[model samples]
Target: MTTTIRSVETFRLRVPRDNGAPTERFRAAPRVRSIYPTADELLLVRIATDDHVGWGEALAPASPEAPGALIDEVFAPFLVGVDIAAGARPLTRRLQQTGRERGHLSGIQADAIAAVDIALWDLFGQVTALPVKTLLGGANVDAVPVYMSEVNGASAHAKAATAALLYERGMERFKVHLVGPPEIALAEYDVVRSEVGTSRLALDAHWVHGAGDARRLARGLDERGAWFLEAPLAPEDVDGHVRLAAYSGTSIAIGEAMRHRFEFAQWAGAGAMAIAQPDLGRTGITEAISIATIMGAHHIPLAPHHSMASGIAYAAALHVSAAVDDLLAVEWGPRIAERSDSFLDVAFLEPIGTSGAWIEGGVVAVPAGAGLGIHVDEEAVRRLAAG
Candidate 1:
């Protein structure tokens, strides 16, 4: 049984959640509305050998077809027939170098590389009979603590109801995604706080604020004992983040837009954020670990962000989250699992415990198997791709 890349495939899927219901917060704050799509879109990659198959996904919230095409036209040719004996990291470096001449180490090109890198790691794990965590230097925690991301509803009372329901389901921490004036955000926060009755709330400003506005919001969050304030300023404003973090009592969180270690190194060096949130679907397993190392060196805790990506991305995040020692909490979208798990044969990650007896903690155990620890429905993926 020779171990070599036998086939490489890509799927672009767009699954609408709640019939593509419009996000109310985005409507209220149109400045950042374009940052997120109305539906969940994904770019999934499959790499197979003689006997085993591996799955990977990239964080393609919009225009996923671009990266899907990149995988087929650019990355697939280079990956097919390659030997998997040396494992994923060496191959990942080589693949990154292939695009270095084209200056394709960031953005959509890096995203395509991310999918291939993750699939290769999955293949490597199965071939070596080890979990991805072990390949990344073993797990430091038994389970990764998670914070429920976004308190959603139509109105303030509805938002409170949503928060209460999640609280009953064992979600102890939450982040409010509000992008506008600080007063509007604080009023919503107060509504949610009344329902959850906990000081473990966080906020995502959607990168819409200037330093002055971010400082005002941070003051409100600090008074409420927020777990963190995420993306307070523009993604490129490292200096602004450093300034805001310097004075804000609330921990500042950043890093979902970044794809490589170099960007993370700059932010880490500048002390731009109190928490580092590298998304595995964007950074891939190799670079996400590298970014984590950079964050660790600066004494910043890793909190890994999650949004509309599929279950493969979620599993990858869990593996990397477990491996990092200075972990805070992985961001968990409350209703994201419904669409994220739609195409999977078996759920790699799911809400633990049953209704009425839900576990009273917000921790997720790392999947317990080789090659990302989940099964992908290839037929379903093919059908979706064909459509």
Candidate 2:
């Protein structure tokens, strides 16, 4: 009879990209050696209390089945029948502990925990009739400034044209995803910068460079006044990042691949990165806030990374971004935002009484309802899950 989590459900979705065929989605990412998923793929979790339901998602850009299976085989059993009032963070810590002996502290295990953690926070908010931001203390900003994540196009001129289009759409900040060789990246940077006209440009090297090459690219980005140079070196090269941070004029940004505060703490303590970017879909709200606190202690600003997330996780990111004091901006993917409402019955926000999240004047207002503020269409999600 006690109010508790009555059930937990997980879904793996692989929706094709609107712009291209799914087979083409696996092409090697530009400027980086790794193959990136171009489709909208993610793992979702739904946690229901006696009277309300809450939703969450994980950043499973590819092979969502990994986290999906983990949730079913390991995480879901512990969540079912749990009291909703225990709170998200405590419950999340317990879940982490439950999996600790099995060596599940990181990787896809973190992604599974991330989904459950977000669902717990969303469930907690609904049970309390409070927004997630209020539950995270209180918001420091009503609307968080956003930056368009990548300027897309096969050619530098084409990419600049895309940047110009975004500029016309009121986007004031943008990051370009560049491929190798300092000169090639710099040349593309020049074209995109020209079109955007000094509107706070950033660059992502996709962790392809060694320290020497990264330092060379960092100097070029610095000369052009880049807001930050992200993932310039390989992900494991913490020492390399530290050395680059010491030598480069541009700020070094990292953390999207990282899943917890402990990892971020190491980066912060070593002065390895100047900016920290935690994806809520990867860390969930509980740990994202923890990462933010750790970064804040080091006076490192947070700019959360977002990619291939549905509306639920997108709302979670915005709520966390609003609550943080050291927010620089939330990475906004227009294509993702455009397709986010496919599984939601309600729009992510109430602008003009419509039910979708949109960027206007370069910012996204925090969603206004309890929990994540969006109603998940379980039927739609299930339909997609069947495929």
- Please report, as a residue range, the 10-residue window in candidate 1 with the lowest summed lDDT: 20-29
In candidate 2, what are the lDDT values of residues 323-371, reduced to their tens digit?
9888898887656655566787534432221233335537877887888
Worst 10 residues of 2 by lDDT: 349-358
CA lDDT of every candidate: 0.83, 0.84
How many Å off is the CA of 152 in candidate 1?
Answer: 0.9
lDDT of 1 by residue, 1-387 (tens): 779999999888877667546653222337783555666778999999998888999998877888889889978898899999889998888878877866566988888888888898888889988889998889987577888776777776787788788788778888878876888888888888899876388888889888888999999989888888999999999999999999999999999999999998998898888899888888899999899888889999999988878778888999999998788888886455676556784344555665543364577778878868777778888887777
Clashes of each: 0, 3
- Rate residue 31 of model 1 by lDDT: 72
Q: Which candidate is the best by lDDT?
A: 2
Score residue 53 of candidate 2 by CA lDDT. 88
Error of 1 at 364 (Å): 1.4
Q: After superposing candidate 1 on the true structure, give the runs of residues whose Cα lies further than 4 Å from its correct spot.
A: 20-29, 33-35, 354-360
lDDT of 1: 0.83
